[model samples]
Target: MYVTQASWKSEIFQVTVGFLPDRAQIGALGLVVLAVLASWVVKLRRRLAYRRAVRPGQPVHAARYGQGRGADHLGAYAPQPGPDDTRA
Candidate 1:
């Protein structure tokens, strides 16, 4: 059994002193460093996974860049006619 500190000790000093809990102080530098390291690890893992998924000489995002904007799909889609001829 542990004895807790009294709220008010002295009768003469009847000041309102509530509960005070003992706690360990931690520095922000360590936490910041840890967070930064975790973020870096996550980024590295993502990079490695991407590399494994997309091998060399292969398009990473074929759908996005293969036949992107202004790409004529085998004459299936033609570019919209520009305003009047460029002879103006």
Candidate 2:
């Protein structure tokens, strides 16, 4: 009789007595949801900050690829003549 009463008082029994998800499990799930929402908020804030930081007239990739006329000297729009091509 005393052993049965002790078993009833165990941590597993107490936690699983009635509800599907106990308070601790619920709190854990809540923490996971909160973390996801916090990550989303952080990502959104970072994107907004990046958007605001770009210069008004410059293309977004210009800084990474090299900006303005100097950058275009070797690209598609540059002169087609190669230095090694000899036409006598």
Per-candidate TM-score against the hidden true structure: 0.34, 0.40
lDDT tens digits, residues 1-83, model 1?
99976555442222322122222113343565699899999999999999888777765654565554454453667665479
TM-score of 1: 0.34
Residue 84, model 2: lDDT of 86
Local error of candidate 1 at residue 52 (angstroms)? 0.2
Q: All models: lDDT?
A: 0.57, 0.67
**Relative to the unseen true structure, what is the C-alpha lDDT of residue 13 in candidate 1, on a scale of 0 to 100?**
28
lDDT of 2 at 41: 100
Count of steric clashes across candidates, in order: 0, 0
lDDT of 2 at 71: 32
Weakest ten-residue segment in model 2 by summed lDDT:
62-71
Q: Which tens-of-lDDT digit does each residue in 1-88 have in candidate 2?
A: 4553456456564466445557777776677689989999999999999998874876565455445355355777666556884521
